[model samples]
Target: MMNYHKRFHARMLFALATMAFPAMASAQDIAATTAPASQPQPGDENLVYEIAEVAGIVKVASIGMDPIKDAAAWRQVVPGESLGRGQQIRTTFRSKLKLVARPADPPTVILLENSSRMTIEDLAIRNGAAVSRLGLGYGAIRAGVAEGGVRSDMQIATPRAVLSKRGTDIFRVEYMNGRFNMSLSEQGRGLLQAIQLQLSNRGDVIGMKSRFVTPGQQVTHRMAQAIESMTFDRDININDIFGLVGNDKLFTMLNDRGFGFLLPFNGASNNIFNGQGITQGEDGVAPFNNGLFNTQSQGVRSITDGNFGVGQGSLPNLFDIFRNRDTQPAGSKKSMNEAMRSIFKPKARPRLNIGRVRR
Candidate 1:
């Protein structure tokens, strides 16, 4: 006999999953609201291109009115060299903290070291008091206080920034020594991974989360890994590291983090975009009848659609190898973009023959 009860439940669950499509659409709208307005238009259905790419004619839009342009002069936002006096400003990445789990009983601690001599107050993470009267570092205290929680040392400070979590799952954020810390167990790590994927969109750090964890086990492990991975002994050139592309704010972040820019494609040598200012094919100028920055009539696809498949048929297609080699590649041979091309593309060259060749 068929199990009618189980079959009925299975049908009910399938119906529920089908009904969840509307919720998925709403979540996409939320993601769109969080995206920067300066992102480009790619005329594809429900697909927004990243900041760097441009159609044959690039569309330019400012996220917020440029303060310098709005005020008719450069306004002083921050004052000093090291994150100047009025340096604190709102950014896309909010510096807020969220509390995930708290034991029914919270612990406390006391302060140990405060450097009074410096222009800015220097508080050691280890030098804090504790309710259990246990040892807690300055990092732990900073992390706790920043998250608006009590450190192991009993020190408490509220975080200035706020982070938005998509799910009910929560975690802790702390600052120690000079580093930021995040703690998540297996489930917590899954939530953290979701957050990180939304933030950076890279899956390199996948499989790093866990279900079971102590207070600081996962955070401490990640922190140690970050420190050990640094190659401080090797010298790096500041300018060489930060390639010139994207917005100035992204540039600033890259510089602050000691990273340089690298475009996904060697756009510099790609003659596909040549003739940007040509009367005819004679001088290699493109007769641009279209406006460069038309968002409304030819705007980017919104995230409202569940289809986030951008690179498939959504983006503007670059010319094929044969076409590019005969026409576009001609102008790219002696260009300074050779290094860029080689770096952006490290695969073996596509074999081409003068006559017909076997595939």
Candidate 2:
């Protein structure tokens, strides 16, 4: 009986050892894997993008030189965190993320809506021009390039097509399943070009096709199909793109963060009324559209009369408000540029009424 009990005990010990071997091996394997890549150091030349804002659940993964062996795990992103090339970002449902490409003179602002995934394939200053390349795995993103002297080379690659832009522009790209769509906002100053690659069954590139999409236009493509172009419907506003309803906090946050320029206004003129009922041109439109006022009327006119609104000069210009810093609220010590920059700085930012709408 003693011998039999000893044999049984030995058998149980062997079974337990066998069961723990795989777990030990897995632990060692995990330890052998590379650790998460560290955040880019300040003033790093490769540091081209920064997280300006984050809402809801958003995470980022840093892909190392050997993506397979050294890919970093995803972690929550914080505002003002800088990202270099090979950084990938994703958002969960009802989440949003804002990124700024600092290489550009005026900086390019990119908003990634909910359920989106994107990778910063490349971002560098090439020959004094900001060159950016992005890969969209799925979902949607809106990008606005501020007007500047140097033309920027920005390209977004989707599964169906590649959208390229030179210079300042505002555009949105969405990719889902096998469908791809790119739309240029009516306020954009530059054109967007789409390139579609024709590949063989083995994924060998055989030929390529291209199309130029102008402001207020859109291009779309499906799986292995020809690209189609159409006019972008003006009814779709920023609120619609972000799937927000009345008085959404995200909308208010965007305005406070200096991204109010992206919000579309009704009618042809990009004007917003101040509290005093005075119409003011949006700051973004004033710099690119030649002047603070849009002479074009929304109503159809049979006769071409440039003298419609003669007294419109009385209306305040958006830039004028910023240029005249004396008009700022009392006790504000920061300049207009400093105030704008403070919006991105967590410690220096001031709390503003988010419910207030601004164009």
Candidate 3:
């Protein structure tokens, strides 16, 4: 009887130990699994931009050290996709793209027009400020920055010049061939500076010259020439600037964000449908008065009537037509399909096509 009781007690002790051992191990495993969650993750402090909307055809490529070699493969972009440093985005004819910065406070919006190629050179939070640098190969982009509370240093670099801004501002940059243009909207309350680089015979930067561009002003520079600053002849129209007259979705998104002041209405005061319809007393009426009805009517007529007036010797006007078109060529559609398909295909080394390299 004693032996039997002793044996039973021994068995119970072993069973309890066995169960407790596993419980102890599980607690350790749980602790190990969750330890990293409290640590800062890699790239957590980096600034990232998400594709809010995409119209027509747009593509993105992962750029490496050698742009020519790494940029050979491109895939179609979709909305909600995130773009980080070392990425390049381009739009085809009749295409437009919208990007909204992550950590959306102090909103930053970027709009890429048709036939534009832009590369994200750097996007990181450094020294307590969000720093961003964009390289524009050829095309137009409109960027709006509202420093809700954080400090921001944003720059758009072109072949000819670099446009830099600190704090809140709405600006547009266009580059073609060797010409560059940058303009600050009427509502821009921040400072904008244009820096032109002087290069040596070996294509090395020797010096830089910078000038401040005030609100409601524009700066233009041509290769081997001085920069020209001028005031806008008339009230700029946001619809015309972004080719967004018919794009109700994008127009509403921007307008609701109080970006209407970027371009003010220009029409007769007596016109019943004045700019008031859009401004809505946000920043008060535009400095220049204009009838919203007339502006929109002209935009619609230009698109529906197919009267782009491209042959009128205005390169910007020609690009505007391409940006505002509702339809793309059949070839573009086919290529877009192929690009999307390539994403799922097996990895194959890209063949280098040495045509005009945009970088």
Q: Which of candidates 1 and 3 is the stronger one according to TM-score?
A: 3
**Each prediction's whole-model lDDT (CA):** 0.27, 0.61, 0.64
TM-score of each: 0.17, 0.48, 0.49
Clashing pairs in 2: none
Per-residue error at 310 for model 3, in Å? 52
Q: Give the best candidate by lDDT.
A: 3
Q: Write the per-residue lDDT of candidate 3 for residues 1-359, one digit (tens) a residue.
A: 96566556644544454365442212222222222212223554767899999999888986433335655587789999999877788898999999999877558999999999888876766666776778888999999998676677677778767777755478999999878888899999876777665554644444445667788988787422453223334444443432222344235535654545544436333334334434332234322224543344554322333334432334754464445333546557665555545544677767687777666
- Model 3, residue pairs in steric clash: 266-290, 267-290, 267-291
Name the candidate that leads on TM-score.
3
Ranking by TM-score: 3, 2, 1
Residue-by-residue lDDT tens digits, candidate 1, 244-269: 22243235434654423322123343
Please give the RMSD of candidate 1 to the true structure.
Answer: 29.4
Prediction 1 global C-alpha lDDT: 0.27
User: How many residue pairs in model 2 have overlapping backbones?
Assistant: 0
Counting clashing residue pairs in each candidate, in order, gives 37, 0, 3
Model 1 spans > 4 angstroms off: 1-26, 29-33, 37-181, 184-194, 198-214, 217-359
Where is model 2 poorest over a 10-residue stretch in terms of lDDT? 25-34
